[model samples]
Target: MLKIRLKRAGQKKKPFYKIVLMKSLSKREGKHIIEFGYYNPLKKFAYINKLLVYKYLNHGCYPTNTVRHLLYRLTQNKINVK
Candidate 1:
């Protein structure tokens, strides 16, 4: 099944994450279908393409726990890192 999750990136200490769409069993930083958002925990920043996110959501895409929390924050306009 297609799933939405975070792909770790950036340097060792400063971690960055790309919110991506990919096969459930794929590797964490492996090939992804698409990248629709990003998160930088240290900076308390996040960005998400709501249009694409909701589109995939309606099409049965599942988001990880962390991504789900981010989405909730997005909907509430709490973490607008764009």
Candidate 2:
């Protein structure tokens, strides 16, 4: 099954993440099918491709809870994610 989730990136103390499309059983950091966005906790930053997200969602790809929450936060923050 395909899934939309976050992939860890960035530095030690300053954490970053990439929102990716991948297989459900794959390793957390395993190969991803698409990298559509990024998040930076320390900077309170997030940028995502909403169109791609919806595309995958329609194709039966589920987003992890954290990623789901991130989408909510994106909307709340009014960051023009689309």
Candidate 3:
């Protein structure tokens, strides 16, 4: 299964995350199929690729809980909820 998730990066105590597309069984920081965007927790900022995210979401690519929450917050105005 393919997953849209976050890969931790940046220095200790000051973390950033890369939104990545990877196989579900792979290591969290392992090779990824693609990088979608960035999330900076400290800055409370996120950069996302909406097109790719929507494509994957429609094709059954699941997002991690954290990623899903972030997307919900960011794209609430654009996405239709059932």
TM per candidate comes to 0.90, 0.86, 0.89
TM-score of 2: 0.86
TM-score, candidate 1, is 0.90
Off by over 4 Å in 2: 76-82
Residue pairs in clash, model 1: none
Q: Candidate 3 overall Cα lDDT vs. reference?
A: 0.89
**How accurate locally, in lDDT, is each candidate?**
0.88, 0.84, 0.89
lDDT of 3 at 21: 94
lDDT (tens digit, per residue) of candidate 3 on 13-79:
9999999999999998899998999999999999999899989888888888888888988988444
RMSD for each model, in Å, please? 5.1, 4.6, 2.3
Q: Clash number for model 1?
A: 0
Clash number for each model: 0, 0, 0
List runs of model 1 lying over 4 Å from the truth: 77-82
| Residue-by-residue lDDT tens digits, candidate 2, 19-58 | 9999999988899999989998888889999988878787
Q: List the residue pairs that clash in candidate 3.
A: none
